[model samples]
Target: MRELVFALDYEPGCNTVADALAEHPAARVRSLSLHATADRLWRVDHVTGTHEALDAIEDAFLTSDYYADCLATEDCGATQTTRVLDRADNTLVLYSDWERTPACDSVPHIAQDNLGDGVLFETRHEGRHYTWRLIHSGEGDVAAFFDDLAGAVGESAGMEVLRTADTTASMRGSNGTQSSPSPEQEAALRAAVEHGYYESPREVDVAELAEHLDVPRSTLTYRLRRAEEQLAKQYVAGRLVTDEASISR
Candidate 1:
C-alpha cells in the first residue's frame, strides 16, 4: 500500500476531477472524495482506472501545488506502523474515494489516477508519523482496511481507538462482531434511514446538499454517509435492510 500525505491549495471538485480524467477516454472515474474543515484547507482523494492512457496527466498532475507537496512526502513510510501503546481518543478515517476497486495489479492505476489526492490527516506518535491510510487498493472494496489500521495505530500508542475511524461503513444488520453504536450514532442512523440516504436517494443531487449547508459537496456526502453508518448500527441491532448490506452474511 502506497500512502502519501500532503496538503493542497485548491477546492475539492470531484466532478471536475472526473471530467479531467474523462478527457482520457480509456480512463474512467473510479472513486472520488473530499474532506475539509472550516479553515478552508481541502483534501480530495480520488482513485481511477489506469489509461494504459495518459502520457501528460502526470505533467498536469505534479505541476499542481497539492501534488508537489505530496511528492515531497514519498519518503514517509507509515504503511506498516505497528502498535506499542496508543490513544483512545484518536480517530482514523477511511478515505475511500474510489470507483472500481481495482485488483492488486491495478494499484498503480489507483496511484496514477489519484495524482493530487490521498491526503492523510495524521499526528505524530512516539516519533513515527502515524496516518490514516489504506493497506490495499483496487480490491473490489469501496471501504477498505480502515479498521485494521486504526487498531494498529491504537495498539502502537497503547490506547484503544474508540471510533476506529472518523468515517466508516457500519453494517446495516450483522456485518461485524462489534456491538451497535451509542445513541448519537444511533440517531444519525435513524435520520439516514428516514431520509432514504442509504438506499441511494433516487434523485438526490448530493452535491446540492452541500450547497444548502454551505459546505463542500464532498463534505456533505461524507457527513451524510457517516450519519448513515451511525444509524446503520441500529439497523444492525434491529435487523434492518437486507442480507446484501451485511458483511457477515
Candidate 2:
C-alpha cells in the first residue's frame, strides 16, 4: 500500500465550505469517516471553533451546494443531505450523504475516479487549505491524477503534494498505541510552540496566544492544557516501557 498526501488551497467563492472556512479562520474540520462509491459519498466530520463560527459553517453547509440538496432543487440530477450528529460549546459533528452526478464533482469523486476502488481517504480543513491523505494499492497514475485535479480546479485553487511513501512503513513509524491529538489540540499546541509560549522566559502568555489565534482565552488555555497533559503522559509511558525492556534484556 502507498500513501499520497496533498493539500489544496481554495480561493474565496471557489468552494462553498472553503469559503466558509476562510471567513472563519479559526474553525477547522476533520474527517472522522468517509466512504465513496461511483455514485454516492458518505462522510462524518468533526468541527471545532467558536460558537459563532460553528453556526456560520453549519449554515453554509446546509444551504450551499457542497453538503446540502441545493443541486437537486436546481434539477442538476444530484442529491445531498446533511445533519448535525452532535454539538458542543466549541465542537460540532456532522454527517452528510451525497448522490453525485456529472454536474457535481467533489474531491472524493475525483479521487475515486482516478485511484479506483479500495482507496482510503483522510482529510483536514482549516482556513482555506484542505489537506488529504490517500492510501491506495499504488496502481494508480498519481501524476496524471494530480494533473487532472489541477486542471479541474482551474485558477481558483492551488494544489501541492506533501509526501508519498509506503503505507506500512508509515504505520510502523507512528507512536505505538498512543492516542493522537485532535485537530484543535494539535493546532493549539503547534501555535504555542511556534510562538515561544513554552520557552523558559515564556515569550508569550496564554492570553496573548488566544488573542493572536482569535479564540477565547479559556478555549486556548483548555486546549493547551489538554495537549500538554497528553504529551506528558505519553512521554512517561514510553520511558517506562523502554526501561522495562532494557531490564529484561
Candidate 3:
C-alpha cells in the first residue's frame, strides 16, 4: 500500500469549522475514527481547547449546514447527527454522522469514487489547516483523488500535497502502528535541525527557515511546534513503558 498526505487551507467563510478554528487559534481537533462512503460519512473527533473555543465549535457543528467543505445542496433523505460523547475540563469527544445527498460534495465522497473501499483516512484540524493522511492501494487512484479533490474544493480553499511514499514496515511503530511526525511536520523539523535552528546559538530563525521551506512563517512555526509536541509525547510514553517493564521484572 501507499500513503498519500496532503493539506487543505480554507478561506474564512468557506468552511464553518475552519472559521471557528480561526476565531479560536488555541483550539484543535483530531480524528479518532473516520469512514466515508458515497452516501454517508461518520467520524469521531477529539477536540481540545478553552471553554470558549469548545463552545464555538459546538455551535458551528450544530448550526452549520455543512461540516468542513461538505456542502449539502440538496436534501434527499439526508440527515445529520452530532453527539458529544465525553467532555472534560478542556477536551471533548464528539461523534458525528452525516448522510450525503447527490448534490453534496465532500472529501469522503470523492475518495469513495476514486479510491474505493478499505482506504484509511486520518485528519487533523488546527487554525485554518486541515491535514489528511490516506493509506490505500493503486498508484493511479492517488492522482485521481487529488484531481477530483481540487476540483471539488474549487476556489473555496487551497490544497497542498505534502508527501507520497510506500508504506514500509519502518514507517510503523513498535506495536505495528503508524509512527509520530507526519510528513509535513517531519519536513519542518528536519529543516530546522539541519539549519541549526535548534542549536545553542541558532544559525537560522523561524523567518529564515520559513523562507527556505517556501512556506509562511506561521505555517512553518506551527509545524515545528506540533512536531516537537508529538516527539515529546512519544518519548515520555516509551519511558513509562520501559519503567513499567522493569518494575514487573
Candidate 4:
C-alpha cells in the first residue's frame, strides 16, 4: 500500500468556499475534512480565519450550488453542539452537516473521481490557491492519475503536484513502537520548536510559524497542539512502564 499527498490549485469561483475565501485576503480556509455518511449526507469541518470570513463562508454554503441542502449549523460560541457556526473570533472552526447534490462538481467530487478512495485530509487557501493532501492506496499508476485529473480540470486550473511520497512504513518506529506523530505533525512541531515557540521571549508567534511552514495560521496551531498532546501521552506511558519495571525488580 502507498500513501500520496497532492497539492492542487483551482481557479477562482471554482466553488462557493473557494470564492468566499478569495474575497478575504487575511482570512483563508486553513483546513477542511469531509466525511460522507450516506448517499448524499456529508459532515464537513472547515477551519477558517476571522469571524467575518466565517460569516461569508456560511453564506456561501447556504447559497452554494453544490450542496442540495444545509441540514444544520451550530451557532457560534455555543458549547452545546459540535458545530461552531457563529463563532465571532479571529479564527473560526465551523462544522456543518449537509447534503451534496448528485451533480456536484466541487473539488472533493473531482478528487474522489480521479484519486480513487483517497482521503482529502488537509486543505489550505492562500492568495487564490488551494493546496490539498490526498492519501490513497497505491494500487494504480500515479502519473496516470495526475494526467486524468489535469485533463478533467483543464490547463487553466493550474494543477500542480507539489510533493509525493510512499508512506507505507511510516507507522513503524525503529524500536517497533507506534507512538510517533504523523510526518506532517512532526514537521510542524519541529519547526515550532526550532523557531522558539516555547521560549520565554517567544521568538516566533503562531502567525510567523504558519508563514514559515507555508500553511494557514489555524492549521499550524491545530498541528502543534495535536503533536504536543501525542508526544506528552507517549512520554507519560514510557515513564509508567519504566516505573512498573523498577517496582517488579
The per-model lDDT (C-alpha) reads 0.31, 0.76, 0.80, 0.57
Residue-level lDDT of model 4, residues 55-130, one tens digit each, is 8776775655342222112121211123555455666666655445443333444445555564445666554456
Candidate 4: C-alpha RMSD after superposition: 9.0
Angstrom error of the Cα, residue 108, model 1: value is 22
True-structure lDDT of candidate 1: 0.31
The sequence of per-residue lDDT tens digits that candidate 3 reaches over residues 1-249 is: 887877887776877888898889889999999988767899999999999999998888777766734743223345778889999889989888888776688877787788888788899888778888888875447788889899888877778886677777537543324367878889999999999999989999988999999985547766898678768767877888889999999
lDDT of 3: 0.80
Off by over 4 Å in 2: 67-77, 176-249
Best prediction by lDDT: 3
Per-model TM-score on C-alpha atoms: 0.30, 0.68, 0.73, 0.51
Best model number under TM-score: 3
lDDT of 2 by residue, 6-28 (tens): 77766667667777877787899
Clashing residue pairs, backbone N/CA/C < 3 A, model 3: none
Worst 10 residues of 4 by lDDT: 71-80
The collision pairs in model 4 are: 76-86, 76-87
TM-score of 1: 0.30
Between candidates 1 and 2, name the one with more favorable TM-score: 2
Q: Give candidate 1 misplaced runs (Cα > 4 Å).
A: 1-46, 49-62, 65-204, 233-249
Any idea how many clashes model 1 has?
Answer: 17
